[model samples]
Structures are given as C-alpha cells and as structure tokens.
Target: MEESDALRAARAVRRSVLGDAYVDGQSADPDPAGREFQDYITSTAWGVWARGGALASRDRSLLVLAMTAALGRMEEFRVHAGSALRAGVTDEEIDELLFQIAAYCGVPAGVAARRVVRAVRAERGEA
Candidate 1:
C-alpha cells in the first residue's frame, strides 16, 4: 500500500516515541480492520497531535499521558505512558504527573495510571 505523507510522518513520529519494535508490532496484526484503524491513527493522532506544532515530543507525550489519565482511559494511558518514556520522559516526571492527577483528577485515576506506569516500567526492566 502506498503511504501518504501524513502516514509517513506519523510513522516516524510514532516510532520515535514508541520504538520501532512496538510500532512494528502494531502493524503486524493480520486483521484488515485493525490495520485500517492503525492507519487512521497514523494519519490523525500521531500525524497531527504527535508530529505537529511547537510542543516537543517529550512534552506532548507527557500531556497526552495526563489527558488520558484525567479521562480514565487506562488502555490509552498505558500506550502513551510507555511512549512517554521512549519520548524521553523520566520516571520521576511520570510520578509527578500521576501525583498531579491524584490531586486534581482524583485518586482512582491516579491509581489506575500508576498501575500502567508500573507495568511499563517493569517491561523496560526498571522495576
């Protein structure tokens, strides 16, 4: 399939933030619908939010994590939190972010965010 400019840019940004292994894994799913959904995100979420504007990838990643936590979206939180690390956010910063969420967005949300953060940290051998 021919890749659009947006898809190309998004893929670059996504890989930079999530690593080539994770990005390739996303593309490895054999289902057409899954591939299509990934493509759509490449053209939208990563293409626009991740690749555009003045916000550095690290800052954008942190913001995305905070937003996902505030909205109680654990799955998205997991993805972005992992990506945040790849995007150069440190564990301490993530901790601060979750603490901020607990203070403002509520304890449950912060707790949920912590679970995902720990899982990702463990995956990276930071446990």
Candidate 2:
C-alpha cells in the first residue's frame, strides 16, 4: 500500500524526536499484524506529535514519559526517557517528574520509572 501524507508527516515527526535509528529499528521487519500496528501508531500517536500544538516536542516527550511511568509501562518509559533527553528534556526535569509520578502513581511506579531512566541515561553515557 502507498504511504499516505499523514503517515509521511507522522514518520518525520517520530524520526525527529526518537532518532532515525530507533524508528528504523522499529520498521525493520514484521508480520502483517505487527506492520499494521506500527502504521497505526505512526499515523495516530506520532501524527499528533506532528501537529505541533501548543506543547513543544520537549513537553510532549516529558508527558509521554510521565504517562508511561504512571501506567507501569516500563519498557515504553525507558524508550521515551531516551527520546525525552534528545528532545531537550533535562535530567533534572525527568527526576522531578519521577517525584510527581511517585506522588500520584505510587512509590513502586515511581521507582520503576527511575530505574528505566537511570538505565537510559547510562546507555547514553549521561549517568
């Protein structure tokens, strides 16, 4: 199937925030179902990212981190933590966000998010 303009814009936004390597890794190879899921996320979630609303990309990155952490989606939290750094979210801001997560989402969720953020920072040599 041909890629739609929305998909193209979504991909550009996703790549800009997440980096080409990560986005390409996600696109590598997949069964039909997986491909469809990928396309859905690219066109939906990333499409919103492409829209450039009042929130800047950095703001959106932080929001994703917080939401994923609150939901206990540690893998996704890890992924977004790296992207958040790339998008200009400072480590201090992330640390503060973790505190907010602890207050609202519970201590365990905050601890899990901190672990993911630490791992992400270590991978980037920022720790």
TM-score of each: 0.87, 0.92
lDDT of 1 by residue, 1-127 (tens): 3587768888888888878888899899899889988898787888765456788878888888988899999998998887776788888999999899999899999999999999988998988
lDDT for model 2, please.
Answer: 0.87
Candidate lDDT scores, in order, read: 0.85, 0.87
Name the candidate that leads on lDDT.
Answer: 2
Worst 10 residues of 2 by lDDT: 28-37
RMSD of every candidate to native, in Å, equals 1.9, 1.4
TM-score of 1: 0.87
Worst 10 residues of 1 by lDDT: 44-53
Segments of candidate 2 deviating more than 4 angstroms: none
